[model samples]
Target: MKATTFPGMSLDIDIQELTPVQWPALEKLFGKNGACVGCWCMFWRLEEGERFQDVKGASAKQRMKALVAQGQARGLLAYVEGEPVGWLTFGPRRSFPRLDRAPSLKCDDADEVWSLPCFFIHKDFRNQGVATALLKFAMDTLRQRGVSTLEGYPVKVPAGATRVANSSAYTGTVPFFEKQGFKSVAERPQGKQRMRKSLVLRRSARKQGS
Candidate 1:
């Protein structure tokens, strides 16, 4: 697919895997609010008590930095003319502790699977295709890494609703995932839906091509 311009942004967008060196870019995109009340994208990594009690902000940022520094399987960042504009995180389902107990989002298979639970697009880049683009990039990255199955937990957007608020749509909408070749595998509580995709690719070829 051709690179497309992000709305209100001058240059075309590109996606790159997140790294420790890119912390500054993530911080800049998240801003002082920490991308939804200081979440820093660690809402699903923390324990239930911590996530619900509002124990975020600098602490959450530090935790995420630790993950990046440790070379843990994180997500990718979207850049437009070198400015970070979006973030999408995913990894082995086990890497995320909270998913173990998330109602209706629990593990359903024993095979190796990656879970994409969240995304954060810069306020200026919202309503654009940033999230979708990042998701596609993620699929290719995962496939090259030998991942065969990918799962996602998305929200069910109300029928006829033009737009959902950022806070409620962080997990993505069902329709969006479907368009990306994901199918509904299960339904979770609170309008949440579980989706999955089986990938077919020559993992060895990716390494050789590189």
Candidate 2:
């Protein structure tokens, strides 16, 4: 993908797909905390019965690297000038096994959907539209790949609150996804929500609808 500079921003932001060669950029973006208390962005990728705490830090980082090397983990990174500043994780629904176990997110069309489960933007770049830019790029990329639907599990902040804490916003905020055309389809516990967006037009059964 080409480098893009969104309006109202002076610096150019480039979005690129994750690959082995781009691991260093991701590493630099994630920093020592692994993008939130040593998560290393492996929360949703964990298998059933796998504990996140066990692989929280360096182990989690290594596991992510392994997935990148083996071509299993998929995501996109956003860069400004030459520094990585943002990330978005997405792939086939089945690839994110944890989603299968989520009671609220369960659906019959799992096989036909792509899941976008996480995003991380550098602290310095937060609220500058980096996340929105990344999401738009991912949508375009997936649509071009013929994906018909995309899903995300974002956190819904409490009413009357103007902003959610950064930690709770990792999955993104409901308004953010709604601005991107996603609709809340189910309510999960703990203010989390299951939202979906259709990437393509569905076939009509009738020539003229009543």
Candidate 3:
């Protein structure tokens, strides 16, 4: 378990990558609704087809499980005092088939580029820095794994907007990505902006400063 602490918060936050054996923890975190719309974090991973619509809840869960079984980078779960509270979905850009059709979002030619497609934080943990902690953990983990770049598709929303639901913010807010050192590289026609971070450059800078 990787732990981080913040001032005034007594408990340490731990984030961990999911394995087939830890599926139960994710099941417990997502609960009965399957993390909204029976997605199971398979929204971008699968192509849009009748089969996709047909596999609503349980089937979607199985599909994600099968991906996890493939042994590639799937995502990480955040735990506070041993209870799972948040999730971040990330992996090779091509692993998500739907990206090919996404307007204004295209993968670069680099083989080591990864994409962060979504985030889900439990209701109780919202605005508590859990997502930020998870993001930091993910950056370090990916850098150590030799990822060249990281990309994200976050929504461009007005500041302090309460009209949006938590579920809709799954793609993440632009400010959140900015705080993580990601810069806007492009924007979609529909207002979803693409952000990129060069892990390779950051690593080089850190080493130089050291």
Candidate 4:
């Protein structure tokens, strides 16, 4: 577990990678609504032609649990005072086949990139830097694992707006990604953006340096 304390915040935040052992914490965090209409953070993992409504409730929860059991799902959970308050899911681009169907969001180096597709923070924890802390931890963890690049698809809050509904910000906000050193690489319709960040020096670059 990684502990972090943000500026102006008194509570210490502990972040841990999601594992089968941490399943109960995730369950508590997602609550009965399944973190936005029973998504359970599985929207991006949906297969082609799969209707979300078909899996919106218990089915989606089961699928996510199965992924957790098989170690196919990757994510981070943040805790404050031992309560899970935030979550972020990321993995190899191919893990989220739905991205391929997203118009104009495909990248040339898909095989080499990891994607951060979902974030959910407890209602009481919103705007408290929990997501920022979770994101920073994920970048560090991914970098140590030899992931050179990371990408995010965050919703763009309209100009002059301070905030959007929690549902609208499920993927995160463009400004948040920009603050974390991600640069806008492509645009998706509906005010969404494809952003990219280099997490580590490429293997070739490191070899040349050595």
Q: Model 2, range 116-199, lDDT digits (tens) per residue?
A: 999999999998889998999999889879998999999988878888899899999998999999998886545779999999
Over the full model, what C-alpha lDDT does candidate 2 score relative to the true structure?
0.88
Record all residue pairs in model 2 with backbone atoms less than 3 Å apart, i.e. clashing.
Answer: none
Better of 1 and 4 by TM-score: 4
Q: Regarding TM-score, does 2 or 3 come out ahead?
A: 2
> What lDDT tens digits, residue by residue, belong to model 4 across residues 59-103?
999999999989899999999988999999999999998888887
Worst 10 residues of 4 by lDDT: 1-10
Q: Clashing residue pairs in candidate 4, if any?
A: none
The C-alpha stretches of model 4 lying farther than 4 A from their native spots are 1-10, 188-190, 201-210
Error of model 1, residue 192, in angstroms: 1.4
- Output the number of the TM-score-best candidate: 2
Using alpha carbons, what is the TM-score of model 1? 0.85
How high a TM-score does candidate 2 get? 0.91
RMSD of 1: 4.6
Instruction: Give the per-residue lDDT of model 1 (tens digit) for 1-210.
Output: 223344543447788787788888888988998899888888888765665446688888888778788878488889887899999998888877787777677765734778899999988888677898888888887876788999988898777776667789999988899999999888644477889998765679568878
TM-score list, all predictions: 0.85, 0.91, 0.87, 0.90
Model 3, 210: alpha-carbon shift in Å? Answer: 3.7
